[model samples]
Target: MLLYTESKEARRDVVRKEHDIIMLIGDSLHDFAAEFKNKESTEYQRGLVAKEAAHFGNDWIVMPNASYGSWSKSELKMWNEKAEK
Candidate 1:
């Protein structure tokens, strides 16, 4: 189904319908589904991802989000050229 709306419930209803499997191609976590929306914290979101780790890259195709939201306040590690051995 081609859903083009801002309502989360509408999207959820589409998902509830019995039919072919739906795949979500999203840049941000919120675009995936209703369950992953309005999360408490980044850590909590990460936990939810971990909980449904198997579906990633298969059912849900994740793309890098350019516009920061939850990760804006995160501390990122510096990239290293060589192995830290």
Candidate 2:
């Protein structure tokens, strides 16, 4: 909800002040929208990011944090591993 609200406010800023969105900076997918929120696999998230590949660096700035993020919670079904006793 906060993300959506902030997105809307950002858009409103552009419309009301005639400003240009040079770039968007964030450390997590939630910074963009619920669609990119914690879920599915990293590949799926990468696919979503690919949709805006051209805008990367040019208009979108994704900050990285090794400490933690949604990428950590995202499930990876292709790891190919199991519990062994």
Candidate 3:
């Protein structure tokens, strides 16, 4: 089997082998996947969160930062869309 460090998405993939990732703690959902990082619609990301809702407090710990990060970017996108309406 190929080591994650040898994979194409090395930065993200390498961490999988480096740690025992039982829980994810981050300021952005994007920390979990490329789809989340790629700026998909908020509804889509929320749906994924809903699907994994049971894991929030346990397997996932999201600390949204207002100062900066994907949370801020997504919020800005939402604000811009609302303004355009």
Which residue pairs collide, candidate 3?
Answer: none
Instruction: Name the runs in model 1 displaced over 4 angstroms.
Output: 1-6, 15-18, 77-85
Q: Which residue segments of model 3 deviate by more than 4 Å?
A: 1-12, 70-85
Q: Give the TM-score of candidate 2.
A: 0.53
Tens digit of per-residue lDDT, candidate 3, span 1-85: 3454542345556657776668767777765555565566778888888887787889778887778765555554444767788
**Model 1 pairs whose backbones collide:** none
Best by TM-score: 1
Q: What clash pairs does model 2 have? A: none
lDDT of 2 by residue, 8-80 (tens): 4455465557656566677876555456755777788789888867867776677888898666776655544
**Regarding lDDT, does 2 or 3 come out ahead?**
3
- Model 2: per-residue Cα lDDT at residue 77: 59
* Rank ordering of all candidates by TM-score, starting from the highest: 1, 3, 2
Q: What is the C-alpha lDDT of each candidate?
A: 0.73, 0.65, 0.67
Pick by lDDT: 1 or 2, better one: 1
